[model samples]
Target chain A: MHSDTKAPLALKLSAIGGLIFLLAPIALIFLYAFTTEEKSYQFPPPGLTLKWIGVTMGRDDVWQALGLSLKVAAIATVLAMVLGTLTAAAVARSRFFGREAISLLVILPIALPGIITGISLRSAFALLDIPFSTWTIVLGHTTFCIVVVYNNAVARFRRTSGSLIDAAMDLGADGVQTFRLVILPNIGTALMAGGMLAFALSFDEVIVTTFTAGNQSTLPIWMLEELVRPRQRPVTNVVAMAVVLVTVLPILAAYYLTRDGAETAGSEK
Target chain B: MTSPAIFAPRSGVLARAADWAIRHPRMFVFLMVLPIVLWLGIVYIGALIALLMQSFFSIDEFSGVVQHEFTLKTYAELLRPSNFAIIARTVAMAAAVTLASAVLAFPMAYFAARYARGKWKALFYIGVMLPLWSSYLVKVYAWKLVLAKEGILTWIFAQLHLSWLLDAVLAIPVVGGNSLSVSYLGTFIVFVYIWLPYMIIPVQAALERVPAPLLEAASDLGATPKQSFRMVLLPLALPGIVAGSIFTFSLTLGDYIIPQIVGSGRLFIGQAVYTQQGTAGNIPLAAAFTVVPIVIMGVYLWGARKMGAFDAL
Candidate 1:
């Protein structure tokens, strides 16, 4: 109580410092994306323009990479959601002998170092003679993505109140009917949050994608290529900004959907 | 969450099917896990084994195909000081990031879980989480602008007349920074920034479970705010700190993108593995290198479980 008034001033300063640090790099890109001096990393460029955006739009490779990233992320998230939901439902709702082990197994992909997962997937693909392709990337992404969906679904399941399911059943609803009507509605926000987060994770994933992707480059892989090769710096910044927006927007949405009062109560479970 | 009764017993044909389904849950779960398990086994396990076996066998120096004969050459080669240095560097970087993130996260998590009211808490939580959505590559790339020769940080230093202080810090001998160069320090700063949120959220979740009344009771017993934190909060939050550290540690250790973009080409084991696999085309060695992180992680996870990380989450 004593510090409430005393705290606000310090807290305000800290919050402002936090905000600046959080935004500085992101904001810098906005300044650079318009810089007319293309060839170097000079501060306070003599001229500023939107010329780089136009240059970036003209690049076919950027578009192709963007398309591939979208496809891979979408497919991986969908796969993760379907499998994760079924697994979460089975494990969360039932009594099983090795449930703990299964639950741990479900979480391990995302939990273990991405390097371990990446190398494991790469070796396994090699054993199967599976070449690095879009499919391999999707498989790699789904392994981690499943963890996100499973976590959300399980949390939502825990919060739905078992009595509601019993109420539906006692009223003569069948298992499918109850699940379709009652269960889905209750966990919809969690599922959506999970899907959004999973998609964002998969979209930006580079380490695992590096191992799984052979020659085909996603936007991140392309950016990696450009970072190593200096001639494409401006285009890289453009694509980087695009990535900042795409990955950031969903994360913001996920936070709001998950942190809104409704979801905070769900989080308590 | 599920009633567990809806699927218990019923008289109709649908109930009969449900009963049959419940009885055959093993098969259903197996079916659900089959694709992923197969993928994990074939891809991950095979790579790991291939990597291990490759270390035991020699690579044909001329061809690099990994010869058929089993020998201890690669393992012996890996035992060298240079090779060991890479592992040490990686561990050091990871440790620095994890430690820094934990320190930075504590105050923020404390504020949110204990002090903030209503919407402000959610806003803080959201603030902590938003950076997570940004693509890892872009985030790493962003630091280039921060730490580069003429980047914004430099500009700010000039404006504040703090360039001399920065120059002195940068002049520290071991860090190899008489001036700001994109190296280990740059990598460390970004790693800490990027992984800080992972630590904060879990620590906040852990702190929330302390129960407000417990803190009130401690305060009533005449503990100062600082004393209350040490006595009541830290012990309650220890498990979460451990759990969150595992995430931060493992992520930092395995992050090839950040190191590749921000660190020097030969800076860490992540890069070593990438180069071995991609450039050197020594898949087995890359696989073998992956073992180091997996072993460390397995141990850390076991430790976390022993510390009751599950309940904390």
Candidate 2:
């Protein structure tokens, strides 16, 4: 807030440069999506067209992958919300034995590198005879997704004073009534923010999905395969541009709902 | 956020159960925690334990079947020079990325934390989150295109008469390659690009929390601006820096797809693990390989925690 603390000219320039470095590649996706050159990248397109969008839309496999990703993200988000809210509700007020370790356990999925989570879940599936399927992907996603919800929910739960619940109970409300009238409204936006963030993570997850998806293709896995083996390169860019636009909505929603604007950052890794 | 209408005051058995759960706080807590404990503890922790166990089991070199008996064979494989090189390469790249990310992130984080107000702050956040929420694979793939020999970066350098500079850099030994897309340098660029936001958000957050008065206090004590920054700001922001580096470093260490898409044919730890488990059916070896990052991140996090990074995180 002080004049002396203002960033110098060099610092301001570097900040702009840094932002450009981050945003330029995302801009490149949109550029290439309109490129007429189908097979390889060129510095500037020989020509420009919107035909790849139509071509990508025509691909059946693309539709299937999109459908699968939506389904998995939806299921994972719901499961994360349930488990995360329960854990938060229990953990927010309790100082039970091993509480620190329990909190660590809750965070472990997001804390460790995703590869560890991926392979561990892959092995556990083999050990337990769970078939590689949509449900398998959902489980892998839910493991990490829970932490996002837990992070958001627990913070809100802590902030929502104990007096509100007590006040509701003293006013002759039953347990369900107190929960419905008092607790739900207080924590609803936090849970919404958490669920939205969870959905975004699940929708775009690739590394963990790589291990658990077996032969199935979520949208990210499909995009990865397409990049590795390009059938129509421009189409991939088009699809990527579309994915970026679609996923942006949920992230924006999460940012909007969280009371602390930066709350969505809690489990971003 | 769901309807939860099932818990509505309906009737007999369900009503009694709800009433009972409400009456006993401890019992309610136990019941509430039961599903989470089972899901995280049994399913998630059980999976981790399974991985650790598999790392102790060896593979049959002849039949290709996994041997159930406990052995040091897989961990031994990790010590083999070829496998050890992969670990070293991944760790080196991870370190470089984290360092570069912190350097690049700091100025932006500083600007955002100190000077940006209202709409500009919102725009700064959106800039970070847009890249993050966008498809991870797509971002990596975009870099591949951008760094291709025929890509715009080359075009820009050519336009600026800097083609010789790029060629000179590309002529260097290991980090160089036929093109930027296939170089170790390229892998480093992509890693730094993708993980920079992870670093910025934390560092910006940490910086924002340090009151302006702290800086004024240092200045008021006759400290030069540079001295105040070194003495007062850096230590205060260390935790946030460490928190961000943990993500950048760990993400770089464990990523397979970036190297697969953009780097030279050399294997990173992620690729090694992926191939061993996915293609070669060497489950034990793959599990053992994973232990490298787990151990590295574990030690790094422990060190970071001691530096108070947990507060920033």
Candidate 3:
């Protein structure tokens, strides 16, 4: 807080450099999407064109993948919100045995490697003979998405005054009425923020989806396949630009919704 | 006013049930927790255990069918020199990326937490998070293009007449190669770029918590700024650094896509698992390979919990 305690010039420069390093690759994604060269990545593109946008729009496969991705993300987010809120209420609002272990169990899916989750789910599905469909992808996604929503909801639950619930009950309100009239309003924004964050995460998820989605191709899976086969390269980049915008909006919205709260959804304590 | 008791008997069944639920808190808690426990505990953790069990089963070398009997043969196969190399290479790269991210993230996190104010602070925060919100695959592909033989880096080096420098660097032992796109250095760089934000946020969060008075007291007690930073700031921020490393390290260790797109066509644990299961039809070996990251993270998380890293998380 003192002038003498200010960060040095070198430190400031390093910070700026770090930001640039973080952003430059993303900038390249936007830049290459408009490149005239369709197949090859020529450094200084001989020219720039918007033809790739038209090409991307014309592809039915892209549209199909996009539609599937939206469906999966939406369903997964809904499941995450319900189950995550319930878990949060139970863990944060009540004292019980095995609470810490339950908390750890909830967080494990996201904390561990995605590949581990993927393979385990794959093997489990095989073992149970559960057919891989859109629902399977949703099920795989709910595991981690629940962690996101749980973190946000639990933090909000802990922060809300316990006396408010007690007072509602003393005044003859039942549990459902207390929850609907008192608790929901308190945690609505936190739940919405968590759901949005979860949706964003599920939308871009590839690793787990790869293991769970047997035949269905989500947008990222399509992109991965397109990358391997190479048909109209710039078109794939254009679709990537679309993916960026789609995912970024929810994340930014979640940020604004939770900005006043003590904790953000993803960076939970 | 009408007496409220008049409405009590008239209440719907749902309201009565709610009242009953309120009276039985333990039952309510159990009901609330059942779905998640079923999903995360029974389904997810159960799957992990099943996978681990698969790892212990032996795979018939001839028919490639999993025998399902308990045996360490699948794990013993992992000890073969080629398979062991993949594990060693992946761990080394994960360590290198974690170290690099922590070093790079610290100064930026320090500046944002200590020096930046108001609008500048918000901008720094968004700058770090925006990239994370974007497509992970796109960023990795962008690096793939950037590090390609005829890509931007080569062009820039050529413009500066430093192409020979890049060539010489690429000529070094295991890490060096013909081009950045197919070399170990390229994989390491892209891995760091992707996971940098995960490291920055926790470090910034940790640094923001260091009480201003602690630093002031150190300086007021006649300690130099450098000495204060070394003694006070670093110790306090260690947990945050450890927290960030957990994300960076585990993410890198589990990633198959990045190495597939950018690195030399060498096997890493993720790739090995993917290929073994998907192509070779060797579920036992794939399950065994997945355990490498699981075990590593188990130990890493235990150490992190000891350091109170979850507080910063």
For residue B97, what is the lDDT in candidate 1?
A: 93
Clashes in model 3: which pairs? none
TM-score of decoy 1? 0.83
Please provide the root mean square deviation of candidate 2 (C-alpha atoms, Å): 4.6
lDDT of 1 by residue, B1-313 (tens): 8556744577888767655664686776666656655655445555656666665666777887877677767666666798788889898888889998887777677667666766766567556655655666677677776787777678889999998877877777655453354566777888887887788778888887778778778989999988987988789889889878987898888887677666645558787887887789876566567677878878887888999987766
Give candidate 2's chain B TM-score. Answer: 0.89
- In candidate 1 the C-alpha lDDT for residue A242 amounts to 75
CA lDDT, candidate 3, residue A237: 78
Which regions of candidate 2 deviate over 4 angstroms?
A: A1-7, A93-100, A249-269, B1-10, B118-120, B210-228
Better of 1 and 3 by TM-score: 3
Tens-digit lDDT string for candidate 2 (B110-165): 88989887776777887888887788888888898889999999999999999999
**Of the candidates numbered 1 and 2, which has the greater DockQ value?**
2
lDDT of 3 by residue, A111-147 (tens): 7778888887877788779999998999999888998
TM-scores for candidates 1 onward, in order: 0.83, 0.91, 0.91
Worst 10 residues of 3 chain B by lDDT: B2-11
Better of 1 and 3 by lDDT: 3
